[model samples]
Target: MPSRTLSAMDDHDPLTKAISPPPDETAAEKEARVKSELEAKRVSDAIDDDIDKQRIAEKRGPKPVRVLLLGQSESGKSTTLKNFQLMQDAKAFRKERSSWRALIQLNLVRSIHIILDAIARDYYPSSRPLMKDPNSSSTSPSVSPPSHAMPLPKETYLDPELLELRLRLDPLWKVQEQLARRLMIHESQWKEGLHGGREVVVNSAVAWKDVFTKKMANKRESSDSGRINWDDPTDPGRVLHECAEDMKRLWKHPLVQNLLEKQNLRLEEMAGFFLDEIDEITSEYYIPTNDHILKARLKTLGVSEHRVELNAGGGLGRDWRIYDVGGHRSLVTTWVPYFDNVDAIIFLAPISAFDQVLEEAPKVNRLEDSVMLWSSIVSNKLLERTDIILFLNKCDIMKTKLSSGIRLKDYVVSYGNRPNDFDSAASYLKKKFAGIMKEDSPLPRTFYCHLTTVTDTLSTQKVITSIKDMLMRDNLKHSTLLL
Candidate 1:
C-alpha cells in the first residue's frame, strides 16, 4: 500500500486482477460486443451492395446496335419494315412478343394516338361555318364529314370537303395509333397473353388468318350491298340533304373547333413526344455510347426524323430507338440528321418502279444518279462511318412482273411508258450506279445496296440478317473478345 507505481502494481498484479474480464461476461459487456459486431456487419453489407452494382453494370454489355432505313416516298420503307422488324413468322413474332422490343414498339404506338387526336382538331374550324340557309338542302357539299369518313357514314369515300379537312389537319398521330393498335391486337389475340390462369394458349396456332379472311369477305359483302349506282340519279338530292346536316353538326362541335385552334401546337407536341418516347425506349433498353438501327416510315415524319433509345436488351439482342421517316420528296430533307449516326442506310425503291425510273432515265440519266443524289445528301453529313443497303422493294410485285413479263405500267400509269424489256430496266440501274461502283472497289464498306421487299418475307430476312451481320461486325471491334 506504500506509493505503488504502475510498474510496481504490475509486479503485484492487483490492477490486472481488479480489471480482469471474467470467463462469463456481464450483460453490459455482452451488449457492447454485440453492437460492435453489428457495426462491422453493416460495413460489410454496404461493400457487398457496391460490388453487386458494379457487377450489374459490367454484365449489361455494350451499347445496342442500330439500323436505319432511308429512302424516297413509296420506296417501300413501310414494306421493308413489314419484312424485317415486324414479327412475320410465327416463331419470330412469338419470340418478340415476350421481348422488351415489342413493349417499346407498343409504347410508341400508344403515344401516337395521343399525338394524332390532338392534330385532328386543327383541320376542323373551332366553330362550324354558318349554313347558307337554315332550310338549305342537307345534300349541300359543305355538310360532309371531316377528312376521315365519320364512323357512322355509309359512304365508301369521305366527302370531298372532309377529305380536304383531313389534308389540312394532320391526323398522322391518329392513323399511326390505329395501325399500332391493330398490331397490338394481332400480338395479344393472335399470339400470347393470358386468356385465363394457364399460359398454355398458343395464339399463333389459332386460325387468325381465317379470321382476317372472313373480315375481308364481310367487308366485300357490305361494300356490294352499299353500292351506289351513280348512273342512277333518282336519289341525287337525297345524298345532298344528308351532307348539309352533317356539316351543320360538324361546325357546331365545340370539340372540333377547339382542336382546330390547337392543331399546329398538337403536331409540334407529337413530334416532340415521339422523339422523347424514342429516347426513353432507347435509354431503358440500349446500352450507352452505342448507336441503334432504325427502319422508319418516311410518310408522316419524313427524313428529319429523330431517334430515341427505347430500352436495353440482354446479350445477343440489342434494343433500339427507331423512326420510319416519310419517303416522299417533301420530307426527304428531314432524313439528313438521321443519317449522321446511322450505321446502315437502306435505299428503298419499289422493284416495280424500275421501269418507270428507266423511262425517266433520259431526264435523270443513271439509276445511280437517283440513288447517288439521295446518298450524297445524307452520306456527306454522316459523322459515324456508315454502310448502305439498297432495297428493291415490292419485290413481290417485281417478281411477279419479272416472271410474267407483264408491263406493270399497263395498269399503273405512273410507271410512265411501258418498257418492252426488263433488261433495259436492269441495265439502266447497273449503268447509273456504275460510276459510283467503279469509284468504290468491289463494294465500299461504307455502303451496301440490295434489291429487297418486305412482302417477300424470305428476301427481307436475308437483307436484314445481312445488314445486322455487318453491324455486328462493327460492334465486333468493340466486342472482339466476347465474340
Candidate 2:
C-alpha cells in the first residue's frame, strides 16, 4: 500500500496557540477557559441547528418548481425568459396592490414592466414600442406577433452609462431607418472620377457592436510605465471613412451616380463628410453586454428560457438553483459543470428537424448523422436516476411529424452511429444517456420525458400542466415542500 501524500491532509487547520497550559492549574483560569469553550460550542451548535432547520424547512417547504431550459442560439430563449419575468412581476404586483403594506410594493408589478421597457429601449437601437395602447388587448407590442404566454415579463437592471445610451439612441434609430430607405437610391450624371457603370447596395441599420462598443487597447508611450485609459475608441471614424471612400468610389461609376441623384443624396464630397458625422453620432449607443453585471443578467434571462425557480419564501431565500443551457454545439461545454448538480435534465429537439436529428445521433456503428449534436452529448452525460424529459419542442410547427409516422430507423441505410427510426432516435437518446451515466456514476435513479414548445398557449399550457403534475405531484412524494 502507498502512503497518503501530505498534500491530501494539508486542508486541516493549524491548532490555535492562544491558551497557555493553565499555569500550575489555577482553578479560576481553568474554569474560565472551560466556560469559553462551552460558549463557543454552544454558538457553533446554534449555527448548525439553524442550518438544519433551514434544510428541513426546505424539504417540507413548497417544492419550488425547478425548470431547466435548453435550446440552440437565436431560439428566442432570452425573449421567453424576459416575458415570463414580466408576467410574474405583474401578478406579484397585482397581489400586493390588494394590501396597503407599502407604496413601493404596490407599484412593483407596473414598475417591473416600465423598467424592462426602459432597459430594452436603451439596449436595442430601434426598440419595438413597449405598449401598443394602454387599453389594447395585445399581449406584447414588440415581440414577434403570435405571442406565447411567457412565465413573466422582461425586467433587468442596467448601469447608469448604459441607461443613458439607450435614452440617447431612441431618436437616432428613426433617423437611421429613414437614411437606410433613402440611401437605397443612386447618384448624379457626371462628376470627379465618374465611371460609366455599377450599382450601389444599401444596407439596413449598422451592427450595434461595430458602431458602439469600445475595447481597451494597449499602446506604447514615452513613460516607462504606460498609463491606463478608458477613452479607447472603437475606430468609428475609420469605419465611416472607409465606407464613405467606398461609396465615393462607387459614385464615380456613372450608374451609381444616377441612382444617387434619384435618391436625392447627391454625390458631393460634402455628403461624404456628413456621413462621417452621422457615423460618429451612431457610435455613442452600445449594447450593454460588455458590462459584466449586465452581461450576467442577460445570460440569466437566456437560461431562464426553459428553466425557472419559484421560491415560496420570496425575499432573499435560498431556493433551488436551476441551469438551462443552450443546445448549440458551441454551448455544449457549459453544460458540464451544471450536470453534476442537476437533479433533473430536460432535452429539447425540434420534431420538424427530424432529419437533422437523425444525422447528428452519437451512437457508433450506425449510418446517417444527427444535425443537433448536443442531443447526443446530453444523452451520453445524463444520470440514470436523473429525471429526463426529451421535449420534442416546436410541435406546433411539427404536427406533420406525428401524422407522417415515418420512423427515423427506416431511413438508416447502414450501421455507423445511425438511428433506424423516429422511435429509435428517441430511444437512442435515452439509452445513450443511461449507458453513459451507468458507466460513470450511480446517483441518478429516474428518467422520464415529453414533447413541448412555448409557441402556443394550448401547447405551452399542456406542457406546463404536465410539468406541474410531474414535479409537484409525482415527485412531491420525495419533496413534501412543493405546492
**What's the TM-score of each model vs. the native?**
0.38, 0.34
Off by over 4 Å in 1: 1-60, 87-299, 302-316, 354-373, 399-424, 427-431, 437-447, 473-483
The models' CA-based lDDT, in order, is 0.40, 0.36
lDDT of 1 at 71: 60
Candidate 1 lDDT tens digits, 1-483: 699467644554777777566669889998887798799999999999999985685478644345566665446564555444443232223212212232233334333323233333333324221112243244421111222322323334434554454343333323323332322332222111111000111232333223433443343322222222233332222222323333334433465446545532222111112333344333322311101112222123333222232221211344443445653343455555645665455666554644333222334422234565554543453423445556655545555556666664454344466464555555444444544544543333444556654645555666666666665566323223222
Q: Looking at candidate 2, what is the lDDT of residue 408?
A: 48
TM-score of 2: 0.34
List where candidate 2 sits over 4 angstroms from the true fold: 1-65, 74-322, 355-384, 400-447, 474-481
lDDT: which candidate is best?
A: 1
1-483, model 2: which lDDT tens digit per residue?
A: 998665755854335334545458788888988898999999999999999996897687654444454554323343334333322332422221111111111111111222233334343425452322233233321111100011122454444543443343233222222222222222221011111111122121222112211111122211221222224253232233333333233324454344444433322211011221223222333211111111111111123223234333231222444454543344454654456435455555454443332112333221222223333444444433445555555444345443456444444333235644445455555565445434443444444555554444345445544655576556633443344
| Candidate number with greatest TM-score | 1
